[model samples]
Target: MTLDVALSHRFKDFALDVAFEAPAGVTVLFGRSGSGKTTVANALAGLLRPQSGRASINGTVLFDTAAGVWLPPHLRRVGYVFQEGRLFPHLTVRRNLLYGRWFARGAADGASFERVVRLLGLEHLLARRPGALSGGEKQRVALGRALLSRPQLLLMDEPLAALDEARKAEILPYLERIRDQTEVPILYVSHSVAEVARLATTVVALDRGRVVRAGPAAAVLSDPEAVPTLGVREAGAMLVGRVVRHHPDGLTEVALSAGPIFMPRLEVEPGVSLRIRIEAKDVIVARGRPEGLSALNILPAEVATVRRGAGGGVIVQFRAGQDLLLARVTRRSADALELIPGAACHLVMKSVAVAQADIGEVAQAD
Candidate 1:
């Protein structure tokens, strides 16, 4: 299903105007707080009506201001997952999950009760109540609850915002499984680049109250010009790799477009595929492979674009193998190297630069 949104809503202090189309995949509504992301989510959920334009899913009109069409929240059939796991405190896991299907009107969804239980690893917790579950388990239950509703689209408004790093780590793999296995497309809202890097197939970036950039996740996240919206320190490139082997030296090898990358050992078994982020600031560019360097990884790269940002700094985009890589250097460095589009260079990155938090399990949309 394609979610087409052209909405305009106004508060006393802020006005929102945006338009975008999200196809049958995970399309992330990404931006900072109060950047109209929640407004878009609310509009799609039928909780907020816009003053102009309309919204629809796969040609099914949910709201059209001019035509006086407005579907109530219940009638919209969109499942929403909030920051907190709003599971019923009084019910067991099985009962709480069944409550979700009670409102489902059509055929079973991409997320059925049995499938969700398996996908979320809730088999052992069926008899347990919410209070007995851990934070990560609760969020997974909440996600399952939303999915079991059989909605056409899922709205996750910073679903991991309330969880700490450890809880986030425990739950992210399940999200990856959901994105890859489910037929239902998700409309996820998040500000964390790590989450976006991990789960989003498409990224719809918002700034202030307007749509800034919207396109495939690979292209948008790798674009040098997107640094302003992505935040300078957070801007990075995403690379997909397959776990080839684990070495005895406490390093796991991943095969990517740029040969292989060796990093700290990963707990996942071999052959598991994953995506990782390389922050722009952590990369160094060299004209040739350096003689002696502490960084063990170096990939052949070609310049794609050079974006000069504030504070005399420059963001250089390069095509490293089939994937993209980014480096943040000063204008002086770029000038000295005579960097321009299509210029060949080498990308130097330390194995440790790829943080544990920066790596995410692959979620290939069907």
Candidate 2:
């Protein structure tokens, strides 16, 4: 399913005008606070009606101002997962999930309650109430509830924003499972670059009520031109690889298209595909493959683009085998090394620089 959205709305203090196409898989609406991310999600879910706009899922128009069509929230087959679980305080987990299933009474592809519970690992908590679950567990039940509605699209508005790091970590894998296992397309709103890197198949970057960038996650994340909009500190590149083996020294070897790279141990088994995020700030560019370095991962690459930032830093994009990676270097360092398009260099990354949170299992191929 493809989500096409074009909206224009006027508020007392802000005017929102944005348009983007979200293809199948998780399409993340990313930006800083007050960038209209939630506004877009609300528009899609029929919670807000823009002054003039059109929204459609695979040609099924939910709203078209020009045509005078507007589907109410209950009539739109779009499941919404808010930042809070918003589960019933008096109901058991089973009942709360069933409430969503009730809306799918006549749907042809309503999700099975048992399958939803298993998919979210909610079997153990089914008999418990919302008060008995942790933040992550509550979110899982919320997700299961959303899935059970059998919506054609899912709208998630910073579902992880309210959680601390530990809770966020706990729920990320389940979100990945939903992205991989379900056919429903998702419009996820988030300000977190890490979440975008780990879960987004496509990214639509918004800035102050407008779309600044939109494309595949890899292309958008690695684009040097997008560094300013994505926040220089949060800019990064993603690499997809398969687990090769685990070493006794407490490291896991993953084979990237560029070559083999080692990182802190991962719990996943050998041959499992993984997506790794390498932040531009965490990378060091060397003109030559340096020896005697503390870093364990180094890949040969050719400079693809170099753009100077407002400050003294320069964002450099380089191609390593089939993948592109990003590096943020000082202007002085870039000039010293003569970094330019086609210039050869090596990306030096410390094995420990890759945080456990930045590594995620890639969606299984269909």
TM-score of each: 0.96, 0.98
Q: After superposition, how far is residue 361 of candidate 2 from its true place, in Å?
A: 0.4
Give per-residue CA lDDT, model 1, range 63-111, as digits (tens): 9999999888898889999999999999999999999888796755456
Among the numbered candidates, top TM-score falls to 2
Residue-by-residue lDDT tens digits, candidate 2, 6-25:
98998999899999888899
Task: Please give the clash total of every predicted structure, in order.
Answer: 0, 0
Error of 2 at 121 (Å): 0.5
Model 1 spans > 4 angstroms off: 106-108, 363-366
Error of 2 at 114 (Å): 0.5
Record all residue pairs in model 1 with backbone atoms less than 3 Å apart, i.e. clashing: none
Query: What does the lDDT read for residue 12 in candidate 2?
Result: 91
What's the CA error at residue 171 for candidate 1, in Å? 1.0
